[model samples]
Target: MSKHVDLPDLIPVFPLPGALLLPRARMPLHIFEPRYLAMIDDALGTKERLIGMIQPNEVPGKKAGGVHRIGCVGRITQFSETEDGRYMITLTGLSRYRARDEVEGFTPYRRFNVNWDGFDGDMGPTERDTGFDRPKFLDLLGRFFSARELNTDWDTLKEADDELLINSLSMLLDFEPEDKQALLEAPSLSTRRETLVTLIEFALRSDGSGDMMQ
Candidate 1:
């Protein structure tokens, strides 16, 4: 993260269910909706080119889902417009924020007033997971993937550093929205790793029982 770059108090938010973007990670997004396409265009014109990635909460009585309080702010690092007028963009996570309030706006997409108090650490170096048990975690991951029949580059995953490996899995895994939110809200990398392990274990235990572990 650049020391000179300042995060905006107000930012456009993309409420995607089950999407997780952590600091120092990159997320590729395909923007086909008119509102989000407009958001991409507007973001490109800004200096920071920032957009907040948040998950929607499933409200029982509400017709539309409510946005989660916590989210990650990412800068538009790579972008290209397709022939069909859709956008293919990659966002590099900068910091995590807590939404203070939703700002009523005329822009098709939602915007929020966010606070970046406890997440200053997110702007720093990649967090080191001191207690990360690589062998154990990888073994669990392999079984979990096998049960789900999900294919991955084992060599690349083995070669990845602690932060990269954990964050990448947290993003790539087919966890439920609530599980992803829990992982996103985890205060430390180690905590997130533990939460991930638990989620995977639960999925594996529930596999083929028709219980449909989220």
Candidate 2:
């Protein structure tokens, strides 16, 4: 899908640690907190139903540097209200943005003025990693999973396309917040793939006992 011409400059942001939403990928989120529930309600009233997913950077003393500079904007594509008033929502990523400024408002949730520069390709089309080495990657992945005693549908993973396989693994893996942030900020699919491999290799080398997931 092409970029939305009406994509707003200001957007509500959800500060979640280790949560990532890459373009062309979908993330399922549960809205339970009162502040976030209000954020959802206000987002649903917008034309695009858009929200920004960002990671919080807690500095030792600087409270101003809380939110990360980069984030992915996603549109709420699926939503359902539970019996207790919580919301189950799926966000389909639209683009990666740089949070230029924090917009102070009376609303409960935080908002940001974002810049979509350098990420035009995010909204253009799904990307494929031409240099992806599937067999080798799977071999490493198998070892990693086995070390952690993690079970997955190997057949299904084999059938998934390059983008889906890489991005899904990047999202689902129990990597540290900084590691996941690196994956999110990677410029391209191939770069992200390389980053994923390096992360896994590091995990393997650091501890064969599979304590990497911890």
TM per prediction: 0.94, 0.94
Q: Could you tell me how far off, in angstroms, the CA of residue 35 lies in candidate 2 after the best superposition? A: 0.4
Instruction: Assess candidate 1 and give its lDDT.
Output: 0.90
Output the worst ten-in-a-row residue range by lDDT, candidate 1: 205-214
Alpha-carbon RMSD of each model: 3.0, 2.9
Cα misplacement distance, residue 77 of candidate 2 (Å): 0.6
Best by TM-score: 2
- Backbone clashes in model 2: 0
Per-residue lDDT of candidate 2, residues 1-214 (tens digit):
3646457889999999999899889999999999999999999998899999999989887876498899999999999999999999999988999998898879999999999889989988679999988888898898898877899999999999999999999989999999999999999999999999989989887775443322
Clashes of each: 0, 0
Global lDDT scores for all candidate models: 0.90, 0.90
Error of 1 at 108 (Å): 1.1
TM-score of model 2 (CA atoms): 0.94
Segments of candidate 1 deviating more than 4 angstroms: 62-65, 208-214
- Model 2, poorest ten-residue lDDT window? 205-214
